[model samples]
Target chain A: MSEFTRGFRAGIPIGIGYLSVSFTFGIMAVSYGFSWWQAVIISMLTLTSAGQLAGISVMVHPGQYLEMLFSQLTINIRYSFMSVSLSQKVAASFSGMKRWLLGFFMTDEIFAVASAEKTVDAKFFFGLSVAPYFGWALGTLGGSVLGNILPEVLMNSLCLAIYGMFLAIIAPKARTSRAVLCVTVVAILLHVMFVYLPILNRVSSGIAVSVCAIVAALIGAWLFPHDEEENEA
Target chain B: MREFFIYLVILVGSTYLVRALPFALMRKKIKNRFIRSFLYYIPYTVLAAMTFPAAVLATGNMLAASLGLIAGGVLALQGKGLTLVAFVCCALSLMTDLIMITLN
Candidate 1:
């Protein structure tokens, strides 16, 4: 397949997933009394799920800016890490314009799709990123405009779809490799700790969860020796 | 009105900062093995941590979470797809809720 086609094909699942999840986010922002444009703009500008959730908290509790900032910083700090990982994949020939444009769409789904592909260049990743970019903006716009026309139960059910997508992405990897499984287990344990522990409960969730997950995953990877062949690029 | 703009500025600027800054700074490729491996697995690890608590807790009630957990775990272990696992668990939970409601 051509680079463009590969990118779009890779990006297709992400686009579909964005449509579903961003719809929920749109409904949420509107329900919280944001204008339709505001809902649309938020989804466009900030593509991260947890980041958007944190933003909602900030919108509701403006005085808690510091808390929200910490949470958002925590949740999104991983993106920098992903960007560094992707630096090798993106072409050296890419123009400054392309770099800036591509930077706008460094989402989890986009990252997954782009990074997983074999021999895809920057153009391909950029191509895949485009559809989700619009899908999110439009999905949020539709949700904001539609504004709870559906039954509450149905809407609640739709919310689970995002989690479903997440599971689908990780489960396939976990099924194949013990390394992924170890990472998944470590992450879950760390999450449970913060959720259950009283002392940790005071910490801002974004930071606490991010730190614990990263630390745990790093330690797990260090202890579990994966076969060398699997690690090669 | 000013507060609204401030919030807007923060939202836009922060989003741009997180997304845009790295690509600009890391002009060359990252050939480092350790950081690359760390980046490769970070999303899955982060996502597991993020999603598991909510999926397990299933919204504050242990009974509901346990029921959902059984449905999800069984279906997942059986090699059903994720949509099936999540929806089936949720549907089962909803049915349980309805049954109790009707019985009462």
Candidate 2:
């Protein structure tokens, strides 16, 4: 198969996964007083799950513009690090413009699959991203418009679906890897601690998550450093 | 309407700023051992933290959510793929929710 098709095929599963999460976001945005189109637009523009969710929360509650800015800054900061790591793996000869385009669609799921590749082909990158991008936008649109049509109970129950996706991503890794299990457990504990702690609880959710992830990973790295051959490979 | 538009622009701008800036700046390879190892462990750890606690709370049915998580965990340990794990978890949670509602 062509490189583009290969990437697109690889991304199809991510698109399916995004549908579940973005659908929830769509319903959430509308319930927060955003119109259907507005929710779709937000999904289109922000493209970050946590970032868009935080934006909706900001809009719902009257907040300073600066607070909203800071919130966005804090929420999406991890993406910068994720983007940087993926940059090294992307084709060295890829054009600057394509790089910019690729950067915009770099969600965690996309980054995970793309970064794991031996080499990121530009066409593959394009094909890989297109499905998830439109899938998210469409999912949001559907949720916004059709969310109300569902029974309240069903709507509430569907909330578990997104978490299911999250579980699927981590459970397998933790099962086989001792270091991963240790870090995962530590990360969960730190996250719970932060959310309950009086002072730290005030931290924006995005920043709180980043801090917890970094701290847990720090401990994991120190304790279980990768093999020497695996340093940069 | 106008205020909404303004915030949308600001929110979109800021989100993109952080996400894209690193890609723009880091054109070359990341050579630092510490940073590389750090990023390597991040996805699963961060995802683990984000999923748990929030997952249970999100369902609002702790009993059912816990059941789903345990089942999902077991399935994942058996080398189940993402689609299967998600499917089984959602189904378990849904069944639990249904059973509880019926009992009530």
Candidate 3:
């Protein structure tokens, strides 16, 4: 199968998982006094759940544009690390304008799936992006137009799909690799600390996630650095 | 409306720049063993960090969410596909929610 087709297939689950999350976002945005079209436009332009949700609050509260900029930069800073890591995985031919375009669609789930591949290229990146991008936008449209129709229980349940996908991505790798297992455990512990500790709990979720991932990965790297030759093979 | 548009621009610009600059600037692979390993382990670390307490609280009921997490984790470890794991997690969480409601 072609690489693009393969990537497209891989992205289908991520796209499906995005529907419920974005649906929630749409409902929230509309309830915040945004028109349905405005909510859809925000989803199309931003394509980030946390950032968009945070942005909606800022807009509704008469916050400054500078506040929006800082909030987005802080919340989305994790993408820089993900993007740099993905940059190394892409084929040499994946460059120039395509890099910019591909970067635009670099959501967390897309990064997870794309970085899992042996090699990423322009076709694969674009193909992987299509489903989730449209799923996000279309889901927003649906939710904005039909707010609160779905039962709250159903909505809450559907939110688990994305987390399930994350587990699916990490579980097998952690099972096989001692380094991955250690890193996963350490990251989870760090996240728990951030969520509950008095001073740490004040840290925004985005910054907490980035710090936990970096610290956990650094520890893993220090103790179990990859052998270049073994990795190539 | 114009103010909203400006806010949108700020949000899009800040977020997009962070994502784009890193990808666009880093054209060559790093040969450093430590950095390479760090990058290699990043996806696992990020996913794990994102999943834990967040997933536990996802369904608004810790019990139901935990059940879904365990079901998803076990299915994934058994080499289930992503779609199946996600589907089962959602279904299980919904069922747990229903049972909790009935009991209440």
In every candidate, how many clashes are there?
A: 0, 0, 0
Q: Which of the two candidates, 1 or 2, achieves a greater DockQ against the reference? A: 2
Winner by lDDT:
3
Q: Could you tell me the TM-score of candidate 1? A: 0.77
Q: What TM-score do all the candidates reach, one by one?
A: 0.77, 0.83, 0.75
lDDT per residue for candidate 1 within A91-191, as digits (tens), equals 66754667677777887667766667554476787779877888888888887787668655445444444455556557767877778788888888887
For model 2, the TM-score of its B chain against the native B chain is: 0.74
**Better structure of 2 and 3 per lDDT:** 3
Best first by DockQ, ranked: 3, 2, 1
Residue lDDT tens for model 2, A1-233? 99989989999988887887788788878777889999999999888776787678678755457767865765466687778767777777765777776678878778878877887878888889988998899999988888899876666656666666667667767876788889989999998988888998887665566678778888988888754433121
lDDT accuracy of residue B5 in candidate 1:
61
User: Which portions of model 1 miss their true places by more than 4 Å?
Assistant: A1-10, A30-35, A116-123, A145-147, A221-233, B1-8, B27-41, B56-104
Clashing pairs in 1: none
> Where does model 3 sit among the CAPRI classes?
medium
